[model samples]
Target: METPLTANIKPGRRPPDIKAYRKAGGYRALREAVLKMRPEEVTQTVKDANLKGRGGAGFDAGLKWSFVPMGEEASGPKYVAINADEMEPGTFKDRLLMEGDPHQLIEGAALAAYAIQADVAYIFLRREYHLSARLLRRAIAEAYDSGCLGQGILGSEYSLDMHLHISAGRYMSGEETGMLNAIEGRRANPRAKPPYPQVSGLWGNPTVVNNVETVCNLPHIVNNGADWFRNLSLTAEGGTKIYGASGRVRRPGTWELPMGTPLRELVEEHAGGMQQGYRLRGIIPGGASTEFLTPAHLDVKMDFVSVEAAGSRLGTGTIIVLDDHSCPVGMTLNLEQFFLRESCGWCTPCWGGLQYAVELLTGIEAGAGRMEDLDTLDSLAAMLAPGHTFCALAPGAAEPLGSALRYFREDFERHIRQQRCPWSS
Candidate 1:
């Protein structure tokens, strides 16, 4: 398959050194942007390409860059922060990119920094990604030595300083403002928008936070025209996505497939179908936070709009498969438990509501559930939906729990009536 992002990645070898990356045209986009394209021109190209954030939210990448104040009003220091804190359950695509293609990220970050005119850029990585963090640091040093980064980059007037900050591995820091707080040595709690990141972030100056995959698309978007990038997708979006799979699949890993590929193809083909003796029950189509899609939804195209049309969000492009032998109540309980533990306690709903969800899900999984628990879960999901929480944490948790209750209500009822998991036999 023609994989854009992983094209240069060779298996069983360390990530390509700076020399190899340069030979393969790694920093070409950054140099072009610094020497040829204006900041606005770069931003406009990305906008035209319709590049969406790969960090769950499908916001247009170029449109986001355009939000940063430019020229004299953008006086003081600006920043570009890479949200490399790949903390979402079942999402390891960013870690794969960072570990297997660090320079790609550096080059992409450079292009984004140039677009936003950010002198300083930060990679807020997850603490668990020690190998990736080390690889990224080495790549950044190599970039500096080659003059692809640091003062007077590519011998152009543009200069950029890049830094790496390994986080304490909190899921909250994956949120943009919370990421800003972590980078600034503050607690990893999300900040209210409106002095949004582009206007006031990273020490009260303009900043732009992009996901690792989102930034990785910049180099390609700059090298190829926007039209070409858009054509790369199987749908309306631009470029390929690093879709991943875990749990019960014969071959569980990530691949750079064209966007809008059918969910069935991803599981039955790319992931090598379910393991022997296991039948597909449902799938969290985009990580643990998205709604569960039953086998009936396997035909749905895996893209933001299509997934939404099918009653789910294509978040992170990572799917966690649920096999027939696995109890949906238990699986949902595990996910809700994670959300409960990771909550920053910023708001009443997420802090309190997630805890309530965990308790209810635990009871249901333990075969002590009441029929009323179904209604309670439904009402709780509504309460935690987007607007009710300070951040997406609770709402995200709501998706799986809510959907499990809807699509797998019989599973919950079976546990309650039988006083044991249906799969236990």
Candidate 2:
């Protein structure tokens, strides 16, 4: 495959033929797993791979699937929701799986459906991703026509039906529960947990929801074997991720790279270094939601565990560089505005706390904030979490804010004490 853990083909192109997929030994594992191997074997392969979710949570993919009740419990009409809502600020890696190697995603989705014994499946796509939606729909249709998605696949009595649903362009819909609600034609608010999607979802049946990137990795694991998949990354982290870097970079674009690729190598080599005019100051290592990483942290490995060790996540593997000219406070405020506006308003803390945060941040950005507001913002973030009304939205909202205060305290102080933002203003 490619440098990244994932095999990315050119955009909007399918493999030349099913024969091509066959030549690559694609769908062979599906046939083997269905006709010869059992669903338990399939799940065990993924578990052995130690595959982590490419979504923000980084939940172990095998563990999440294991949540599905098996044996007689895995009876008919179960569902697996493919999360294609790639709305995280710096996250667009899933778009590659959708656009480039659609068949890989289809095969992967089929594997998960088989493993979970899902009778039907849905690919919940972001509304703004009209192109991806169209491409996936076409791929789904192709799978059905090719007998890959329909009943008794390769002579096994496993019948599966799949469909695609588009989401309205709202950030909240990316949350797993929210995606389920939206799929059911609800108003897209998060459902209360304890009854997580694995228990009651999509018409009150047990469901398995996985990110697009996570599912796309399945076919490779099945086709190439789990150890090969595990060894894809030189480090223990294994597998490939589509890495994207923007802002102040000479060549700002996405490349499918190995998981343990050093952040410095990505910026300095793959990304062609920072642009000539803007010297690199610090970076919002993932998307804007992640904490900023100073140049001192460049040598850190850019994998989930390593990035987390460096005080940020390998979230969606999107690296947003901040140049010396960019004001950290202004950039952080901009991100806060996004979170504040996108709150689902299902919970009191997020609804009110985020609004209060905006006020405090705006005051600081506009030179009206007092030093005390910094303390207040931190306290507000603490109160807004685990205390929130909805899903991960509010807690995810606090991540960057809390991290910014911790890492870039001086920048926040500059905004407040100097009575002005150090950036353009």
Candidate 3:
């Protein structure tokens, strides 16, 4: 299952050697960019491609790189952190790239270091992803031994040093700034904006944090040029997306498809449709933290702008579809339980609101919900939105609950009205 850049990889198997990857033109981009292309040109290429962070925010990647200072101070010993803490609920897509093609990530990190004039790179692996950490460490040692990481790599003055840092295995560590905090060995809490990570990050150095997939796009962008990469978009936002599938499906796995591919195509054509007896009911579109999309939105193009226009986002591009006969309240309850358990306790909203959410959603699912309970849930989610919490955890928790209430209000009402689940036996 290969695309332009990853075309040589075998399906369901880990990628091949660093030498083979290089033979197939892997580190060529890093070498070329660091030695020939200007750092500004690298940022311009990314801008032309409209590459968004594959993390949840969908922030522009090129713009993020542009935020780095080009002064003499920024030219040496700067940093690039790979947010490999892939712990978002329903977001296991990064695990695939990490476990399968470790060198792709490493070379991409090297290329990013060149683009941003950074020498230090770190991959923040989650505690649970021990296997990914092991594999990446192996690949990093291999890169360094092969002279791709040490000083004067491939006979160029430009050098990139990669390091592996394991997370404490918390969900908050996935947020960009919180990840920065975690990487610094500080308590993982969201930092205040107006001084985003680019301005000041990772031990007070100019840092650029990118998702595993976002950085992995670099070699392709450099090798094929930005226009070729941008042309991969099925919508206005260019590049491919990796979609993760699970539950009530004939086959559930990650596949790289053109960005903005339709939901119906992903479900029906790619996922092999529903299981024997199930029918498509809705989709989470990104991760469980994202809002749900009803069957009416099956035609929505899977991109930042289109998913937003469809009243959701293309966060992480992992689509968790719900089939008919599944209880929506139960689905939300399971996710809320996760949010409650994974709260970093850095704020009241995520810490306390998640507890309340579990209780409220549990009462609804248990047929004990009061009429006012729905409003209570909505109000809580409202209070937890942007600027309320230190980071996006609380707000991300609210996305699904808010959308569930909006799109499935009647179902919620019926559960309360009948004091029983319609889908239950």
Candidate 4:
């Protein structure tokens, strides 16, 4: 219930200006990191706090920061890139944060840049977020004018220049490496790993791409010690998470809850339960990319490990509920269509495979599917799994369809047997 991240956000309102934000202790962490703490010290503090990335991938943020090589042998002109391309379906948490508290992000970016010893930072914001972009621009300018950013921040020798780059608006750009390519004015395709962004990124230098929410925790971790930060969570991880819900929920909104809050609590308590005349059926536990969780698994904790254990993921903490009246096949088909359209067309599996999935799911949704189609769907999903693709795009695209086939097989069969949507009647 201690909503650290959403504390400054007011419903249906723009963020307070720079002076007000400073009054609320906004830039203190940035100043502390730059003036009082060493780069390694800042990173170590975050590491000790067990801070994890909130950008779908639950990677350890501190570990990511520590991966950037240091000393003479390390690469020069390292960069810190903020992943603000919030395009994931059912995920509006980052957009809300950006729109309501742009200064929080700016302060977070400055602290992150200082932690990584990067003089330059870029916030790769989505083009659709015009208001968020304007707010960020104003916040950055205010930071510079107030001496919290640019040339000797807070009278310290350290300096960080922040740049806001509006993306061309591709879903693939949400991928860390793909975001880097987009920032470089190239096609928004995911790059091969092994020499990850931490080693060579953004103009071919050591870079760290952090989510908007992930870095926002930096100031808190610094101001209150690692122990305080760690205790914020009820689970093994540190800090509260912004959990969002949509679809048939009566009160569909985002809430800053403990990291391991129950999926049932999120839906029933936070979302005000399903709408009248709608019974809970299934849930896309994370974003559209995550596997579906049936009512049997509603008690599952909404954390990375627990959700994964339930054959889904806690991606971005955004839940899209499925009502009993809704046809699962149609739902999956809609998601597959999104994947198909968003594919960068770089690889066969993702580009071609997603198209194939779209075709198969569309046919099934339209009552033209056969019994063999289920097997074909399973095969296609396997082909898109982790090692079979260039990036997580294909793997993620496969999750919903694959799981829908498993949990809602009877629904698919009903559609096929009846030669029409079962839920239509």
Candidate 5:
């Protein structure tokens, strides 16, 4: 109910063009924002709406924008970057938004750029998203032609330029500083913080980097007042979320549900529950990076605070279901291998520790693991925790592994004791 994000996205239909989009009240928010509202007013509206970033980190969007040095005293040529690189495993929500309603993203990005007084904007998209890239390019052209972008947008004094940059294809490239590096033709290694992208980014300018879904909420937040936007959610987070599900479920897909919708509703109602003959084991209530939750936690609200209170993040709001037929050790090993390969080698904890974790999990799955290996895996998880890494990649990698060990310790023992994976035929 009240799915503002996906109301226009009809299955099997091509995305609406500029004319069609306007006819359906698309850029009205941009028009109102540019012609009537001041840049600070736009930022204040979003802040009042309590819109949180949907790109894994649930940071407040307006609070983040408020960090930018504003007014005539602030520096010039500030930037806004849209993190369209939807590389998170089991997360395809951004791809759907970009391909389904490209103009919505453009309008949202323009609104965000306007709010921050940004002179330029960029969509740092993953290279694998060719279709999304094409759709966005066309949408950008349409916006420019319609005078929604470029010099003196809508004849206002504020001018903005936007570009689409295809990423160099690293999961780290989705990280704020890493995406900034990759956008500048450098290796996608994360930059050390303190002067975060807000104050200094993209050629050392004040750049605001936000996720696709996060920015897409801007147009709606502006079109409807902050109260309307906040009321759309079932919880305090404000607005709806594009919750997705994959693996073993009968209907594995994404849905635009009220924020804080229960995990049980997503799996049992929207995802059509597990396929026949498959009993629920656990669910990674976010992307691959989050911890696992057993069937008992199904009633937990799918919000940032609730999910985190349940001991996992509401990462990407995409649940990856694990069935009874699957092996937890094998699943963890597969996930660890992905994290190991995707690591940028920027830090030893991430690069070296993930490789060790993978090796241990591999041995356990291959029937060569010892009971002591579980202790070593636990050590690796602690070593890879948040403060030890240059970025979040290693910590994210540790979540599923650490939680698997916690929730499914018996399964790891079963593999070791039996000398083989029980689920493997």
Candidate 6:
């Protein structure tokens, strides 16, 4: 019931300005963090809070920050890059947070930058988010004018500068390494690991790239301490989650609920259940990249570990429902096409394997697929498994395809056997 993230957000109205935000207790955490807590202390508090990244990866936010080299003798000119590229399909939670409360993001970014001892921060946002860009620019100016950012923030020696960089727009650009490349004016192809971004990133300095929502939690985590943040969740993972539902659900929107809220509650209660006359067929329990879940798995908790245990991810905590009227094979084909087009072409498994999967899916949906193509599709999924790819794009693409085959084999068989889509009118 405590929606801390969205409590200050006023729907259908402009976001709070600096004065309004200040009166409402915004940036207090940033003040406390800069004036009192050491940089390492900030990071340790977040780690103790068990705040995991809201991004699909679900890695611990503080754990990721801990990897950055600290101390005066450590790397200089370190950076904190906020990944605001909300490119994942069926995932609009980040956009809502950014559009609804821009300063929260700015304050959070400053806190994150302070935590990592980084003087420079960049917000790598998608070009399509024109409104978010405009509002963030305004907020940044306000923060600077108010002494929250740049040259002795809040009268402390800890000065930080923030930059907003609009991306040209690519799904690959959302990946951390790929985001770094795009930010550097290089092609958005993913960089190889081992020289991981924590040690060497953005002009080859220690840079920490965190998702927008993940950074947004920093203010709350610092304001209330780790225990309060952890207690906000329904499960082991700390804090509330912005859960959303799309497709035939009567009320398709996002809500900030306790972490690990059940999937059934999200779809049936919050989403208003399936639209009249329709029944739930399946669900992609995150964004387009996550594995599909059948109706039987509705009781699964909507958290990282629980969802993973249920054989999907709490990806962006957004659910895309598949109604009885929709065709599973066709849906799979549609998803594959998006993945195929978005492939950065940096790795053959992603570019090459995704194209082949798309073609096979297209053929099957078009009534030309041979039964043997099923075997080939299975092989394609295996080929694009996690270790075979340069990044998560291909592997994430494989999730829905592989899971669709498992849960909707009958649908695929029907399409092939009927030599046409059964649901086609």
Better of 2 and 6 by lDDT: 6
Query: How do all models score by TM-score?
Result: 0.98, 0.94, 0.96, 0.98, 0.99, 0.99
Runs in model 2 deviating more than 4 A are 1-8, 11-24, 73-76, 387-389
How would you encode candidate 1's per-residue C-alpha lDDT over 320-424 as one tens digit per residue?
Answer: 999988888889988999999999999998988888888888887777888898888899998888998667898899899899989998889999898777776
RMSD of 6: 0.7
Task: Give Cα distance to truth, residue 127, candidate 2, Å.
Answer: 1.2
Each model's backbone clash number: 0, 5, 0, 0, 0, 0
- Off-target runs (Cα >4 Å) in candidate 1 are none
lDDT of 6: 0.93
Tell me how candidate 5 scores on lDDT.
0.93
The runs of at least 3 residues in candidate 6 whose Cα sits more than 4 Å from the true structure, single-residue gaps closed, are none
* lDDT of each residue in 221-313, candidate 5, tens digit only: 999899999998888989999999999999999999999999999999999999999999999988989999999899999999999999999
- Native-to-model Cα distance after best TM-score fit, residue 96 in candidate 6, in Å: 0.7
The true-versus-predicted C-alpha distance at residue 375 of model 6, in Å, is 0.5
Greater-lDDT candidate between 2 and 4: 4
Residues 1-425 of candidate 4 have per-residue lDDT tens digits of: 57878888998877988898989988888888777889899999999999889998899999999889876577779899999999999899898889889898988888888888887999999999999899999988998899988899999998888999989888999898899899899999989997889999988899999999998888888989899888988888898898999999999988898889999899999899999999998999779789899999989998888899888999999999999888888899889899999989988989888888888777877778888988999999999888987788889998998898899989989888887787776
At residue 163, candidate 1 shows an lDDT of 94
Reference-based TM-score, model 1 = 0.98
What C-alpha lDDT do the candidate models reach, one value each? Answer: 0.90, 0.81, 0.84, 0.89, 0.93, 0.93
> Candidate 1 clashing pairs?
none
| Candidate 2 residue-wise lDDT, 1-425, digit = tens | 45533444654465334556557666777787778778888889998888888886788888888887788755447998999888899777888767776677778888998888888888888888887777777777777777888888767899888888888878888888888888888877898877777778888888999988888888778877878877888577658877889898999888877778999998999899988888987777777567778899999998888999998777878898888788777777888889888888888888898899988998898889999999999998787666646687777778778877887899899887789887854
- Provide the global lDDT of candidate 2 against the true structure: 0.81
Give the Cα error of residue 55 in candidate 5, in Å.
0.4
